[model samples]
Target: MEETRPAPADLRGYCGNCFGLCCVALPFARSADFAFDKPAGTPCRNLLADHTCGIHTELRRRGFAGCTVYDCLGAGQKVSQVVFEGRDGGRRMHEVFPVVRQLHELLTYLTEALALPAARPVHAELREALDRTDALTRGTPEELTALDVGAHRQAVARLLFEASELTRAKVRGRKKRHRGADLMGARLKGADLRGADLRGAYLIAADLTGADLRSADLIGADLRDADLGGADLTGALFLTQPQVDAARGNAGTRLPGSVGRPVHWAAGG
Candidate 1:
């Protein structure tokens, strides 16, 4: 089967078509990221009756920075409109929303993996996985809630790793292997990290100014409070919006076409 390129918009959160599932289905605690504690299955106090945030514009200023970084990978609307058919199934919707969110996240990665020209050797396998994952999204709420998402995730993860390796292999010179490395607050200014394996690396508050990160596999990397000012992330693999949103950047920070610069980056956050 021929692989069709996936558009970034298709994997993005469209809250207008959603039922605020993220606000109620996910829990948060009082921390630097959140102002107060919110339990799962309960609507956030800021959530309006019409399924919008009352403080959407002021979320970051009001200590709800965590909310600003979240994207459902379009799962909120999928669960609201497709699985539940726009009816608020309450507990059922909440239960299924998280499951679908996980699936959607996987779909996002699979879609991206299929787009990598360097990973073309595995394109057929990637397409099959993408199709299967997409089909699973259309399953009944009962099927979704009971789905062994972890098992599926592991299987997809292996495929993604292979795709990452194939794409990163094209880069000349050393490919730094920092998989799951804890580098929080490390000074890496102007470092050359092209084609690096940085999966699950803790880069919290690290200074990455002018870093060369082209083609780096950043899947599951923690970049909270990291300075990305003047950093180049072009062609970075599996770099999600949430990770970008969690970091600090400047107008000079270069990004891949797949992910957008965080709005807060402009405000010097």
Candidate 2:
């Protein structure tokens, strides 16, 4: 029998174990995404000393809507505990935060790859890649800081692309092809997007209300402020917690099991 791989924890940010890295280490511009401008290495005004968001319950209402969609993919805790030894007062972790986040994101992709039945032919390769990435996450602060994550990401991305092809190989139809298209602000409410190829689509603020997105490939799609209320996203590929968080959804919205309903979602949203 094949070894039973342990089910992965929520790939989303575990803020309790995190040192609020996103709130401090990353800068934000005053644009549609962020409500205010913030310089790197400075904590957000809403971040409490305990590393919790003071306005967590009302981040959107308080005009900090961008924070609602950011997930560190468990990199925050890894950087906090492993890299900094839970010290939480070091610039080294901050400097390497982006790379570590990328590694964790790769791990998330590999983990999902292992779960896809159609990708079973490449399961061994996926497992090996996941193991390597898991090892990288445990690397020392110096090793992580000096890592070339872009090259590594390219290598892993090739494997992920293969996995995506294998998974969607049987999805035959006159599917819509919108890869990397600028669909921002498009009024796509009730759109029929089943089995569509929407990879890397700029869906920022696109109204996807009641859209049928079953089996749609949404990898790298920017869903920021996209309305997904009452939308059917069953079996949507490459849908992440952050993307779901960025969209407007209601109780009737269908999401993948890997992600939970966003706290900010309402019954009527």
In angstroms, give how far residue 123 of model 1 lies from its true place.
Answer: 0.6
lDDT of 2 by residue, 14-131 (tens): 8988888998899999876678999998888888989999888887677877787788988898888777788865677788787788988888888888888998988888888887
lDDT (10s digit) by residue, model 1, range 1-269: 45554466757899999989999999999999999999999899999999999999999889999999999999998898899898988989999998988988988999889889999999888888888888888899889988999999999999999999999999999899999999999999999999999999999999999999999999999999999999999999999989999999999999999888887788886
Off by over 4 Å in 2: 1-7
Candidate 1 achieves a global lDDT of 0.92
Model 1: residue 244 alpha-carbon error in angstroms:
0.8
| CA lDDT scores, all candidates in order | 0.92, 0.83
Q: Please give the lDDT score for candidate 2.
A: 0.83
TM-score of each: 0.97, 0.91
> Residue 81 CA error for candidate 1 (Å)?
0.5
**Model 1 stretches with alpha carbons more than 4 Å out:** 1-7
Per-residue error at 237 for model 2, in Å? 0.8
